[model samples]
Target: MSEVNISELNDSQVIGWLNRGGLKASADGEIGLWNEAESALGALSAAQVRTGVSSGNSLQLQARDVDGTSWTSFLTLTAGNTPTCAIDRTVIGATTPAAATFTTINGKTPSAFGLSLWDAADAAAARSTLGVNKHYMSLSQSSGSAIGDGDTRYVTEAILTTAEGYATRLYPMHTGTITRVIVQTSCQAVNGSNETATVYLRKNASSDTTLSSSVQFNSARQVYDVTGLNVSVSSGDYFTFKVAFPTYATNPTGVLMRIDVEITY
Candidate 1:
């Protein structure tokens, strides 16, 4: 028979002998044998447990979930100076992290602007809201008077002068509904005679389709609403504005025109 005296050993030696004999000792001198059945009995409950290391200026106790996928700090103990614990939510892998709720972001209340959530897919792309409403305006000017003898001329280009006017094509930034359109023009006749003018909004190469009825110009500045006159335009679709003056005259020189379009997605 093998015999060992526990009173003849130090604390570590006694612990080793007891471990070899399938016995465990708690901090308070309680000795017991642990088995699979004992493990299923209950779990150890404690708010704080020593890590068996010397206490430093700061210490943090972290624990991982049962799946061992994520780790979270549970307790922090400090001795000298109080250390700050900063929790950062940054994904180190390619997959995005779980979503979190926040009242304010970057010091601005998201709910104030009706912003509720943001879905971040990756580091490069993120989505906040859906469609947006936008407005655009283009202006063109001509120096000399072109005879308006019932001929269609692109209003965006200066036909009678060498000056290059604004772009003749309007490209929408997004595919949406064209809500409104307004055309404003300022023209004068050199002979001081009243001239009739017709403005047409053309899409693509279909110039026969009139967006609006012929607007009569009385040799003065005027604004006309062409919302109901023009057809709906898609994203990247080009728009052409044409002006026709059947009665050519020298008085309608130095024409200034502006076109405004509104789109909603």
Candidate 2:
């Protein structure tokens, strides 16, 4: 009979031989099967099998044992102790994150990312149609108006009066908290002792005036900026600007004015 030592084989060679129904003997020789109860077998050396696997390599189990235990061992590929596996979305199985759970993720803070609709809602605010939380709108009147002697008429709505040479324009504002309103006034020539121009912001019409500011023009052409006026506006509400001369003895030529409104949602 021929004898084969099991210690001289590797794992794959033993498995291959077992798959083909055990080892074959030389011609005209019978194979001898040695039992562990009768003979002692030597342990295989650790280096007898292949070693030194490449980095980022992994192993997977082929099957489980009868008791549901894994028979094969697997290598978990990682970089700097962190697993480099790609997790599928299906594996997460969560639709949304817990409250305040996403304040930071993967070492990134919320301020570093763009705000979504849900984020805006949480802050009790909303984005406009232009995807902006705050915006500035401006309206200007460039046509020259002459404030004649002793003119005290409050001009509302853009109207060119042939008798008084004054006009007004209506400004439509969006629904938001008005942060600031800046009114700028400029004049080319002033021909009166006290040439003062009063600018008033009227809500809805001429009667519902909310805020007003005045600027006095000297002998030379000058520009004035009126700022720090806060007012809250609602949807469908319109505003009008009234430019009136209170103490003008002679007409003021080349009068220009602009209004800037800052709003936040």
Candidate 3:
């Protein structure tokens, strides 16, 4: 037996070889050849990778079946957000993201950008770099003899007389804007409709500046706060919480109690 050069054969000779079965069959009958040809044609082609604007504020990255009947979605690139992929159909003009099975974000590494930002020597340095403020103040009664100017009692226990004007003398540790002034009381003033808790800030040796608006309290064992404030302050600034009960049925002695300040830099 010798190897035949098929290119050297004439048309009739080639036809003779074909009629005698030249192409090998992988399965029974000629069906395997047809299936192989169909598979080779049905596989994904480079020309099917498509990209275009299907609608306003929307995009389509799609593909279709080689049979020109069925379709599939490979990577659907959204406009406003990162690209996420899912499913096996082509629904062009997609505004919202797909079902979010395969998510792909477009920025950052190691969660907080990098590991070097968290490295610092002291607690203060670390707080500074991380943009976090840690300040806590539990101001109690100031050690004074009388009840008018030097009285610094936090109204819960020290408000003996209705005329004993008292407040909490606080020295701020951080430099920031006073965002919240929270007050906690054991009980409400007996007739404290006209009563209020006011905050004051005096930087260095300046005049007493009223920082935030007054917060009224009526509920017992509940939290009351003065929020939505932008009171500017610096370190070593003196602050005061004055609970004023101008008109009262019963003197709110043990009623007006605790004060907590919140700051943000």
- Candidate 1 per-residue C-alpha lDDT over 174-247 given as tens digits, one digit per residue, 9 for 90 to 100: 66656677777665544324656666666775644454554545456778776644356776677767766666
* C-alpha lDDT values of all predictions: 0.52, 0.47, 0.44
* TM-score, cand. 3 vs. native: 0.38
- Poorest 10 consecutive residues of model 1 by lDDT? 36-45
The lDDT ranking, best first, is: 1, 2, 3
| 10 residues in a row with least lDDT, candidate 2 | 34-43
Please give the distance, in angstroms, between residue 38's alpha carbon in candidate 1 and its true position after superposition. 21
TM-score of predicted structure 1: 0.43
Against the true structure, candidate 3 has what lDDT? 0.44
Q: Which stretches of candidate 2 lie over 4 Å from their true place?
A: 1-104, 107-131, 150-173, 191-195, 206-212, 219-230, 249-251
Give me the candidate number with maximum TM-score: 2
Model 3 clash pairs are: none
Which tens-of-lDDT digit does each residue in 52-133 have in candidate 3?
2222222233466678786556555443344433433435446533443222235433444334343454666666677786
Better of 1 and 3 by lDDT: 1
